[model samples]
Target: MSIVKEFKHVNYLWEDSVAAKLAGDEVALLIYRSNLLGADLRLTNYGGGNTSCKTIEKDPITGGKTEVMWIKGSGGDIGTLKRSGLAGLYVDRLRSLENVYKGIEQEDEMVELFNHCIFDLKSKAPSIDTPLHGFLPFKHIDHLHPDAAISIAAAKDGRKITQELFKGTIGWVDWQKPGFDLGLQLKQCLAENPGIRGIMLGSHGLFTWGDTAYDCYINSLEIIEASAEYLDQNYGKKGPVFGGQHIESLDANGRKRQAAAIAPVLRGFCSSERHMIGHFTDDARVLEFINSKDLDRLAPMGTSCPDHFLRTKISPLVLELEANANLADIDDLKEKLTPAFEAYRHMYKAYYDNCKHENSPAIRDSNPVVVLYPGVGMFTFSKDKQTARVAAEFYTNAINVMKGAEAVSEYTSLPRQEAFDIEYWLLEEAKLSRQPKPKPLSGRIALITGSAGGIGKATAKRFIDEGGVVVINDNDSNRLESARTEFNTQFGKDAFAAVLLDVTDSEKIVNAYNEAALAFGGVDIIVNCAGLSISKPIEDHTEKDWDILYDVLVKGQFLVTQKGLEVMRKQALGGDVINIVSKNALVSGPNNAGYGSAKAAQLHLSRLNAAELGGDGIRVNVVNPDAVISDSKIWESGWAEGRAKAYGVTVAELPAYYAKRTLLNKIILPDDIANACFVLVGGLLNKSTGNVLNVDGGVAMAFVR
Candidate 1:
């Protein structure tokens, strides 16, 4: 095995060639510098920082060049930043806001003023840090929340340490929330410290500046590198970290097993206010800190950086279990979650009650975004998969910050009142209000069998459009890879996970579900969409044909659903299972004994499972459709010709013939079946289960009596 290595310093990625190409363009050079800084987490976390450049642009009304400050906009990552993602504002107009800035009490009123100062009519929305950048004297500034910079900024004696480490090269300012007031304070600090290159905001982050882009980028990296080296020199000098690691970490496979076993329950608990997607990690650092003695003491202090707390909430909820717990201890861990969660809510509400300002927005969700397990790993939950994943990344940043501060000096979190004020600030509430409402299935995860193409693909796409995550699968490797790429492109990388495996193989089924558990928290809806067909008269039906049909249709659904139960049952949150049965399950005909009987078995299996699993809050239902010819694998696999032969019609006429026979004369399609599946599980008829919905255009014989 190869030894793993850790990077101790942020790399200098500036290339003179790349900069030379954009020689005359200041805004383009600014974007290039921002991307280089953002490419490394050591510089700053994803979406955690902002960068800026001040250049002269022609005033729309004046017909003259005026100073304009271009800064990173509200919600995009700096690493992937583009010119359009910047909010270009008139610096003169921005600085003019001091005329009406009625002191700290009226600071929030300043946000509205920034909109009136937009230089380009199409500029992106400005962030709260706009004033911080516009008021600065430097031509280029980097306001980054680098984990290393934050470590020194968050220490108990941070200001004193700043004086000692950089010898006044970087000055310090006491903590104040970002706004008009903080901007003025920064201006004052620069005035007091002659020849200083940057100002380190106490318990927040560092602000570094330079006359040119390269100077600014290099200055930022140099400070971060020094901070990291200082911490590395002193870490554990006092004693072994976390009192010498009281509990041992589970082995690699056991860590995954334990993480998967309890992810669903943790996800459900975190979804008390709204459904949530979950992310799990057992990185060595996470395991190291979680298994330590100080886990209980340090977790409650909350994060010092506002960027960290904004995504992770004030603090994480710790789910404790016996020392050295392994996969067999999952039941005990599950039992601990309920009490731990309930207590966490109580704790958070009390914090709000104690610290909320009169004008603060109403209390938001009390559920912890991050959860910690002593012998296992970390789990983070949020309204979407990406957010949850990012929350975990942020908490990991917090852990690193904590470790660094503790090593060099006492680690101090933001004061309680300050944390609350920043968390529930009114401006933040307004920003949240402007966001679009979540789709009905925003936080759900569905696993659809045979989703490489056809009905399965359509159904998965529908679920995804409604904001559901999916675990898609097919036995065909080529089709599965194509579907994976297509979905990843159309929806997003986080929208779906594709697995290639046979449904009838139990080992493969178990392995596939494990992948689903890790990709998402677990499954909340399971669709048995994999199927095949065989058409033969009773006399001509050979045993091989019968076995193949049953194996692919009946046995396949049973095996897939059986494995899904393990995940759903543990979640304890009510779930939905939609079976894509056929109308032939109810309406019998000649030359279709093998396929039709298997469909009937599938229908009965749904009913039986509904009866058996209902006590566990699982609803099993069937969607029976006929003649769904468009994009159907079953139709393409010789079933169309066989059905046409039996009906004494050409293959091309099957759709018209089937539609004509129906009362509504509607042609059934894969999309129609997809809609039916969505109807059953999309929270429309939550109370109705053990039922069959016919998407066959009013087939009277297929109707349930």
Candidate 2:
């Protein structure tokens, strides 16, 4: 391995007056900041890394003075880190220890150090690398198995390979278990060459430190960026060629198609952008790693580092492709994928059986983190979007490292049990246990009218997001197709349906509802958002306009609710009906004779239904939205105007205007409406019914009767 000379890195975050007493005001800030840095770096995708700060402290009870250490508490993300996230430890205890009392079998030693060395027994387990970080002489130390750094390190004869690429610049370390023994080894190596700038952990990561914390963070970033740049320069390739089978381009239509596909996946996975599926395919690494076969083995070593280890575990699916192959067809893709998934589960169970505590919860499901379908490439899954995206990046980086390591010698990873222990660790198990799955709505069916617009669509999305299946209906065939494509794409076929039928037609409404129940088992909720408006003063109101408005706004709602109540009461399963009315119903509005009258009727209708359906356990409510603008008549009319008259000041500007009308100065969106629906049917409002909820932008404060 090539070792580079050390250089002095400047760290601006440290105070020169930092005192020897640990937990003192100045040192407390330093320690807190150091933990923040560790959490930030580690919380990054494939960025399982650690940071530590050394300080001297006086023991309060014993009245004796000693050096103390504080490290990142185990099990939390750096992104959400605070002062409380740190685990307190006795530095003197660690520094003075001559030798590990327990024999140094890697796994056992790691557990012991974590349990004994850390003074905060109730806190999260100290990272397995605490000993290594503690052994370093630097006051501020940082270690990260950055995807970028490890990707380069995992190359065959990585020392020589990287030497050729980086020259005699980067320091290197052969892979070693991270604990007391490794700590001692690093202490000796640094002593031999005190001038080294950083340590490159072979098949692992890179380390950088300074006398202060700022230098440590910046140094780590610089080294990682350098490695990333090197790979981009040497190994980067153009986008994959699909053999002229017409993979969609990232155009407007392409984006719509992509959104549809992605939306369903998000819904089915019960993930929000912040939860599990966000950023899943946003990174280049997802695409690159999906196209490779390095995910076959089970090892806690992971794609890159520890944080992202949960994303892809240490294994992904491996697939091989012939000269001619098709990746677009779902059936063809599944043919290659199904068996691989089965094998991965089989292997995962074996690993779990070998590693975990006997009482540990059995593996819930055997879904591979990364799916490598050879010709079709690979994909990654996680509990959240960021995690999945980060894992994908780590896999790409790891693939590069593994390929290089293979070039030097056969690239191999740790045994199955070790990875299983890390993957199914008690700490991680706790995280999974804390997540409360969406209830009551999970697997239930709901039908939403006017679902192609903001509120209806948003409500449908919310229901689907909460694990309920939704059948979205719209009069406009185009909009219906759009909703269908969007929901199907995001939730897969399991969570969504799109029907093109106008609610004004009573026969059609009944038929569609029957069909939806037939298709998805049974219906549980109905949101009547399919209403029409006619802006005309009483004197100017036409017979046609009045009739059409009443037909859709009042008649349509009545017909659908009537049919829905009948079906719901027959099934004897309590259900819900939400009517989209208007806040303007409470206060009068000019040029809204037909629309206002119809909405007023719809509101009273909801109360009547609520009173009648109470015994059947059905809930009926009205949502009076004042000025929420989505893909609706107002937005379309404004867009079609093309600015000459500025029909409604453009769809984008509508929110600000609406917000200004509200006391809170807040413009509500579809999601706000969805959240309200979540509360209503979510069984939180179990006792109340015949109520009108206002989702308007503070237009009026009068409660619905």
Q: For every model shown, what is its TM-score relative to the native structure? A: 0.94, 0.57
Question: lDDT per residue, candidate 1, 427-459, as tens digits?
Answer: 888889988989878999999998888789999
Candidate 1's TM-score = 0.94
Error of 2 at 563 (Å): 20
Write down the lDDT that model 2 would get.
0.60
**Candidate topping lDDT:** 1
Give model 2's TM-score versus the native structure. 0.57
Error of 2 at 481 (Å): 26
Global lDDT of each candidate: 0.87, 0.60
Candidate 1 segments whose C-alpha is farther than 4 A from its true place = 1-8, 15-18, 323-334, 649-667, 697-701
- Residue-wise lDDT of candidate 2 within 399-426, one digit each (tens)? 5555434334445454455556556766
Error of 1 at 293 (Å): 2.7
Residue 87 displacement in candidate 2 (angstroms) = 3.1
